[model samples]
Target: MDRERLIRYLSLLVIGVAAVLPFVLEANLYLLNVLILMLIFIIFSSSWNLLAYSGQGSLGHAAFFGIGGYASTLIAVQSGLSPYVTIFLGGAIAAGIGVLIGLTCVRLKEWFLAMVTFGFAIIVQAITVSFLASLTGGWDGIASPRLVSSQVPGYILIEYYSILAITAGVILLIYLIFKSKIGMAFLAIRENEIEARVSGVDPVRYKLLAFAISAGLAGVAGALEIHYFGYITPEIYGIDISFWPIIYTILGGLGTIAGPVVGTVVLTILWDGLKVFGLTYERYIIIGAILILSVIFLPKGLVSLPDKIAGWWKRRQKKSPDAGT
Candidate 1:
């Protein structure tokens, strides 16, 4: 078999093993929480990776994320809809907004465009806090009904496995997308917009499509969060929320597929471990340090580290293989 097929099969085997892990391992509440949180960030980081890899560094993505959370929660609670359906609706709404905003600013440069999108995020947060009192619960945000109860050990296992399933599905979907012709188009646009446009690739349509899809996926994550945690607050939608995705992506590797997973695992472990030492608030410091070191030493992220090491080791072997003789 070729290298790509071998790698794909191996990766799938690993994921399949992980999906059934909770069944073989002992069930513990703390471990369950960690897994759930990891799943949440997995969704967040991967979606953000799509946009970042596509060359649109949006700082305002939290707007759609917040919208998705609120929309799903409100629909589930107020409108008396199923949590499942509301989730998709929330994502759709967020995506719709993304389409509009992406179309509006598709022409802007990276930094300036980021700033404009940041402004939009700020606006969304403020609106959620302001005179939309009846709808948004004003300033405090809305509280959601619990989607699960009892927190039994079996239920915890179920939740863990459910998250595993969702995460797997999302990762697979994205992997397929990136493997297709559209993924190549996105990469071309990222590498050089001028050249892509000159070659007849329509930048506006694809950028808007990416933005909408990214926001929609983020919405799915946010909605799942509300259901998983059984609560929602405006604070969750604040600018503070954006930092997590940004840090996770940068720490993992900006463009590589595995970077987000690596980043999420490392940071999640660090965050949980430090809580025991009463350094919970300092999670950001460690994460920031990781980001800085990642940028300085491994600018492509941890995903590229193995490849670089392998290349170096091969060169060394070629140079010194007969030394032992």
Candidate 2:
């Protein structure tokens, strides 16, 4: 089969597995909760990947993530709207802020841009706790409504399926975006901004667009997470939250759609698996080692491992005849 067709089939298989996984596990609430969080991080990681695709990397994505959560929670509480409706509205608010952030970042690149974004997260966190404390509840945090009330029968199962569907939809939307002219523009800009401009691609426009979309998606992920946990805090903007997506994307494959999904799944498993063995803080050491090794040996991320192995095998086979001679 052709590569594209194979990928299409593989994508469907993954989705199918996710669809039936809750049933396969007999609706175990613990596993379902884990899967739901996994799906949310997948969305979050994919959003980071999209920004990276535009040749921009952020170190403060938690800014948007927390913003979405706080905005959605506030809107839901005051307006008495469903969490479902407020999630998208919160995303929209994040997108607006993302555009404003993008304006300052379009001219900067690499570490400079990263530090700016990192600074924004800190600034945002401070604002949330100090300035917006009246509504946000300061360092104490505020309660959030659950996506589905626990009063409902099998609510955990319902939440899983709901998040799973949203994850699939988000993936599909990202796929479409990646296959469009906009995707091409992003690639060109990433490769060579001057050349892209010469070719009539507006780097500034596309970069802002990338920021808006990426931040908006991240906002949705954040909203989903807080609603799932039934709380939102300034801790939502923690450094760890910002770094997780970057780690997932780098380990999975920076530019590929499946990279975030693959990376998140593998790392989540490894992370939780180690905890089961009472590793605790030691798990970070192991994970850090693995990430370093992956960078040195599998820089393209886990998604490229199969191809790397295949090529190595081909080279070995070619040398076999010479060795005999």
Candidate 3:
């Protein structure tokens, strides 16, 4: 990784440890559960950023998320496999589906591509809902197999650290990819697809590659959820979940690496805090208001808030440096 990204990864790792430190010391289930949810969403939002930054607007992201959840959960429950193996199996399965979808749809432009992806998501959800007896549990969903099956759970701390380690690894991987040659190429595509094509860039290959990567990351997030929450339902694969990454990405900031992470933490905390008030639906209401205000005032996202505030302060300092003095 580059110097900047190395520092970011290190910082995230430290913060992740700190976030789970409560569980390590006293095993606060509430805090641990919240942290798990935040990190899972962070992974989801980060991967979605990859595809969005590449200029591919996929509306079926939850398709991969759901697929991963089911794949890992099924392996763990039915086959009695280890969690470690199932995680990767989930990601790989999602990646294969992503590649197929990407290859088929990447050639299209704008709304067509988005619509196609949206349709794919609906189809997946339908299949999950319909096949109650076999692959999916239908509308009822299935109970997840336990990753840690013991009541005492001696190595709970180990599990916490494992999640921290995996999340850090994923962040580092995304950082490296964004800093690579292909990442820059993806940015070029985002800037102007026609120009990128004119410059002899094969839009199909790079876009497909991005789709595979993005989908794989989403799969990882789903796998984590299944293990952490111990449940899988058709709701997990619906369009609502797909919209989450987009919402979080926009809330945090687009085109910035740290944006999604910031967005995930802030929104998750707000949502959790609001739940105690019994105004559960109000969380979305607040989020919607924030989204609107953000678009109106800070189009770039909350990440840009700092920069904007800093710039304003600098200008004021220049204009009235000695007024008070």
User: What would the per-residue lDDT of candidate 1 be over residues 1-325, giving only the tens digit for each residue?
Assistant: 5968877887788687767666556666777778788887888888888887778888877887788888899888888886768888988998898888888678887898889888888888787877666788877666775445446547666666666777888888788878887787789899999899898888888888888888888888888788788778777667767778887888888876777777887888888887878876587687677678878988877778888899998888789968546
lDDT of 3: 0.82
Give per-residue CA lDDT, model 2, range 1-325, as digits (tens): 5999999999999999999898899988788878999999999999999999999999999999999999999999999999989999998999999999999999999999999999999999999999899999999999999999899998888888888888999999899999999999999999999999999999999999999999999999999999999999899999999999999999999999999999999999998889899997799999999999999999999999999999999889888876545
**Predictions in order: lDDT:** 0.80, 0.95, 0.82
Clashing pairs in 3: none
- Relative to the unseen true structure, what is the C-alpha lDDT of residue 3 in candidate 3, on a scale of 0 to 100? 66
Using Cα atoms with residue i matched to residue i, what is each candidate's TM-score against the true structure?
0.91, 0.98, 0.90
Arranged by TM-score, best first: 2, 1, 3
Model 1 TM-score is 0.91
Evaluate model 3: give its TM-score.
Answer: 0.90
Where does candidate 2 have its weakest 10-residue lDDT segment? 316-325
Query: Lowest summed lDDT over 10 consecutive residues: which window, candidate 3?
Result: 150-159
User: Per-residue CA lDDT of candidate 3, range 227-288, in tens?
Assistant: 77778888887778989888888889987788888888888888888888889677889879
> Model 3: residues >4 Å from true position, as ranges?
1-20, 23-25, 152-156, 198-200, 321-325
> In terms of TM-score, which candidate is strongest?
2
